[model samples]
Target: MLSRREIESYESQGYLHIPAVFTGRDICEMERDHEFMTRHWASSGQGWTGPWRKEYMDAATEKQSQLVAMHDLHFYAASWMQAVTHPRLVEAMGDLLGPNVELHHSTMHTKPPETGHPFPMHQDWAFYQHQDGRYVDVLVHLDDTRHENGEIRFLAGSHAQGALEHITCTPEGPCTPHLPTANYHLKETIPVPARRGDVVCFNIFTVHGSYVNRTSQPRRLVRLGYRDPENPQLGGQSHGRPGLMVRGHRPNPGGLHPAYSSEVGALDAFKAVPEPALVG
Candidate 1:
């Protein structure tokens, strides 16, 4: 659980960092999974260009494609799912969002050197629907994330207000069509530096994005979206599109994961709505 001070920091700053959430072995296994998947995609004659090809491109080099479709739909089963669902990480989320929460979706952003591009500024909630209370996103960095590596940049206290309308800029930088409700708050952008094992958590409404990787190495990270159980579902579209909802754990069942321990059970706060449920 996060300390009161830590929680306050998150509230005021819109994001917080937790260090060493994984072990060296865990990182090794995840990297192996990434390498295996990239090689598999390359060998398949996919040519690393298309709808899902972005996943293969190295973020630091921008030489590889971005957003490759390597793993099956249920990202929770991907190589890094174990680390993504770590107990400490879960408990901290439960602390902020309450004991009951559901894993909404998972997407990986693997930026390569030189060619890595910036993620446009946008509100995650603008894409997700939640009838419950608050929504949270946990970003797990597989590699050391730094400013040079195109780490995340966020505006503090942006969540206290609602979503801001966004428009495309001439060069493709994120531009708000108008000022956010938070208003002229000095547009502060801070880079969240994380170690190999650290995870960064933030509210959904927070305005955040990342820059192109200037370094020669890859910057890899997984973004998992979670929501409170009782929150009302907003009538809209699915954020992860196509993959849809997998079965949810009842009362947040923990044994669903083979690696789950007594201290950690399933997130009790949510019921997974099926993909068709959105239209239903």
Candidate 2:
């Protein structure tokens, strides 16, 4: 569990970098599972392809840059299923998001050696919109991260400003939302270099991004989104889907979610039951 001072710091700074939260054994198991996922799963390029990316990376680096990513590790790997619900992480989540902490989602992000992709400055809110800033993104580092290896950078106390307007990439085929390159510069943000087993936690509203990895080694990290169950998600990623409880019991059980619709596409989510609770 985090100290009261640490929790206060996170409340004030809008982010907290916790070092060596996972043990060597834990990392080894996760690493092995990640390797297996790389081989079995259909990982794809999830790099941000917008004009904002150009401002963060050079033309040559941009061409070579690629991000290997996949969502929801729990479905495939038991090791990760256990890792996401690790006691230490759950305790931290409880500390940040109150007693009842529910997992919104998790994703594996592996930046390949010497040309890893870059992300533009933006809030996770554009992807998953919650009514409040209670959602926390916990980044579990499986490998050491440095400036040369695309360490995540955050604008200090930017979460205090709440969600900002994210623009779509016009020329780019898919609309990847990001803040304007003119205002949110990479140089102005603070880089957070972390070691293997370290976990960084920050509010979803916080503005953050990363650069291309220049090292010969891969930078692996798993992002787990945990939030207060009562946060009431509006839309975006994991919309209307039920979340796994990692800490205390969920508030107001057996209720309708906003993502539910009469459309057949929402059938599974609509039929989901609260009895077989996924308690972490």
Q: What does the lDDT read for residue 96 in candidate 1? A: 76
269 Cα displacement, candidate 2 (Å): 4.0
Measured with C-alpha atoms, the lDDT of residue 71 in candidate 1 is 31
Score residue 40 of candidate 2 by CA lDDT.
90
Error of 2 at 117 (Å): 0.3
Best by TM-score: 2
Per-residue lDDT tens digits for candidate 2, residues 1-280, read 8999999988887889999888878789888989999879937574766777667667887777888888998878998889889998898888888889999899888888888887888899999999999999989999888888889999989999998999864764656899988888877889999989999999999999888888999889889999998898888887878778888886656563333344536426645454544334
Question: lDDT tens string, model 1, 1-280?
Answer: 7999988898787788888776777778877776766555422222222211133234433443343333322343365566556677778887777766666676666665655655655667655655433777888777888777778878877787766554423254543232332442222577788888688988877887676677878787777776764454564434322222212332424323122234433432223433222221
- Listed in order, each prediction's TM-score against the native is 0.68, 0.90
Report every candidate's CA lDDT: 0.60, 0.85
